[model samples]
Target: MNDSRSRWLALAVLALAQFMVVLDVTIVNVALPAIQTDLGFSAEGLQWVVNSYTLTFGGLLLLGGRMSDILGRRRLFLIGLGLFAAASLAGGFATSEGSLIAIRAIQGIGGALLSPAALALLTVIFPAGRDRNIALGVWGALAGIGGTLGVVAGGVLVDGLGWEWIFFVNVPFAVVAILAAPAFITESRRVQGEHSNFDVAGAILGTAGLFALVGAVIRTEAAGWGSTQVLALFGSAVVLIGAFLFVEARAKDPLVPLRLFRVRGLSVSAIALALNGGAFLGMFFLTALYLQQVHGDSALEAGTHFLPMGGAAILSAVIGAQLVTRFGTRAAYLGGSAVGAVGLLLLSQAGADATFAGGLLPGLIVFGLGLPLVGVANQIAAVAEVPHEDAGAASGVITTAFQVGGALGLALISTTATTRTGDLLAAGAVQTDALAGGFERGMLIAAGLAVANLVIGAVRAPRIRPDAAMVAEASAA
Candidate 1:
């Protein structure tokens, strides 16, 4: 009984930490205009505020995951929390754009460490079956809400306190999480022989490859895709990625054991997760821009506009958890994707004259409902077949897909919207109307991606039965 109590407490602590990490990804969206005004960021340069964190977070995740398994989850989790707190403090005090961007990147590294360790700990604590399913439901719910929560918090902080408060806000949460972690969470390490050494070469190759790839994608806005600089970066990324794969195939203890991909569920989940991340992140960014730029809303008002969506996401996440237990992962994901696509299509109708009630609210609620279903379902499917020792690796893969896909998707959406806006300007349209048209086009693209996710979920995601162990345990109880 005491053990169960401890597990629940540990889960609360871990979920709180996870919320902080995920919140940072979108908290800045509501504060972007403020940050840009104060920091003198060019429109293109402003993207780095978000991408710097995501790039490092995505790049180092596999390394962080393996480190957690090798060193110990508790140790890594503590270390990560400390780094994150320190970085947040630095970010709050930043005097220049370079300093803030650099600090955010460090924070991402800390997140890369903190996130997977927390997730691996969750997986270790909850035995696979009903208990794990329930715990994950709670975890996914927190994750689903965290993004919207950030928007709300960012609005309040930026409006009431200052843009810097968004960074400052993390400090208290991190301190509390760090202080409370040791008591509730137990230490865990991979049970494999102690002689297993960290794969240094694989880490370097993988991190560098991902950073370069994402950098190249972001560069396409300024440097055309066929430009010499972009071509070179792309070539380097391909080579580095190829080398990483080769090393993983040969390394005695690889950072990412390529063997894990053999699991059909994990493989499909990774692909679907990438698509979902791209669409999800792009939608938030475009919508926020639409509200602030086109509708002439304040940051606080824009944040409040998202409240309905957040509520719907929370409700759908609970239903998704139950669906996972009954029908299976595939059905939940497919159904969610179809619903999300419809929502995106509806959202594409927003224009300069559109009202929040008639134009945004309905689509926002419907999309919010489907978004959590995809997130929760993909998360469960990604790690379902992973062994205990590789739990961290699986968690890392899931998050890496999310962060990387978000970065890439944001780049695509931004580039496409900018081009369309420029074309409209050339054709003699007013700036506001052109901007709104560009945003709507981006929404349509996002809808198309959702359709692709639905197809993948239907074709690739395998149906999963409840673990026999869970059934046996229930029968005995």
Candidate 2:
């Protein structure tokens, strides 16, 4: 019993670390304008600030998690944390756009190593069953809340302090996580098979492939789909990705064991997670811009308005966790998409004349309510069958899919919103009102994607007991 208490304590610390990493993703988003103005960035290159971190982190998650299993979760945790802090300090001082983007990319590498290690460590610390469910519930809640927390805090800090404070804030989180690493969480078994070695070529190919894919998508807005540069980039992505799959199948100790994909729930949950990442996160990027650029709300005001959305996010996640524990993983997953669709439908009606009280607030709240369920339930579903040996890789696959979706989502939606707005304004529409109309159209498209998510979940939900298995694993860990 005493041992169990200690495990929970360890969970608390690990969850805090997870929160810091996830929160950084959205926190910087709210500060983008400030960072741009202070740093003097053009619109075309500005996205690299976000994309650099996301691309690296998402691209290398599988490798990081696999390393944690081989070396030591605690050791890697500290390394990743320390690297993140140092980079943050460097980034806060960055005067040139190139330097800032380079540092952010390095930050992504740190996050890739840190985030999955933290999660895999939690899997090791928590015992299986009911306790695991609760532990993971807490974990899911923290991650879901982290993005919003970062936004609000970023707003407050950027307003009072400066954009640099956003990066500066990570210093404390990284410091505390590093300090706490040695005290709690005993090292787990390293090396899955007889020999453990990283596939460097595979890693390079996969990382380069994903980066190429995302780069192509981002370039589409500038170069057009038919442009030679866009075509070559996309072609390179396809070939590299195809090579990665062939390499993984033959590698003795692949980063992601293909066998894990045989798990039904993991595959379905990951696909659903991709949709969730693409549509939901994409929605946030678009809405934040609409409120700020079109409406001209101060960053602080925009952050304040998001309080409702954040609140709804927490509520839905907690509720979804309970539902997963009570009903079933598949049910929880399907229900999340259903609820999210409703929220997106509510939000799709937003227009240029939309008021904070009448138009945007309801949709934001509704959208928030459904957001957590989409994330928490799918996560549980994905991890349930993950054998202790390959859990991290499985989690990485889920993470990779989601991050890829998120990156593409944000880039695609941003381009769509920009193009549509341009077209409407060129048609002699009111600059303000027509732009508002473009935002409305964008939200509706997001809603339509969410509806597709619902249908996919309904069709694909498999027979499984994810919560029961998750709790069992947590309690035993």
Clash count, one per candidate: 0, 17
**Root-mean-square deviation of Cα positions for candidate 2 versus the true structure, in angstroms:** 3.0
Tens digit of per-residue lDDT, candidate 1, span 1-477: 139888888999998899898788778888888888888976666767888888788878878877888899989999999999999999888888889889989999999888878887987898777777677756756665787788888889988999999999999999999999989988998887852667879877987887788778767767889999889999999999999999999998787889989988788888887888888878888888789888888889999998898889878876766776688778888989999999999999988889999999999999988986777677777777779666556766776887888877777776677778878988999988998888888888888889999998888888775443432221111
Q: Assess every candidate by TM-score.
A: 0.91, 0.90
What clash pairs does model 1 have? none
Residue-by-residue lDDT tens digits, candidate 2, 141-244: 67657867777887888889998988989899888877777777777746467337777677879888977887887777678889999899999999998999
Which 10 successive residues of model 1 have the least lDDT summed?
468-477
What lDDT does each candidate get?
0.82, 0.76
| Candidate 1 ranges with C-alpha deviation above 4 Å | 1-9, 122-137, 183-186, 192-195, 384-392, 467-477
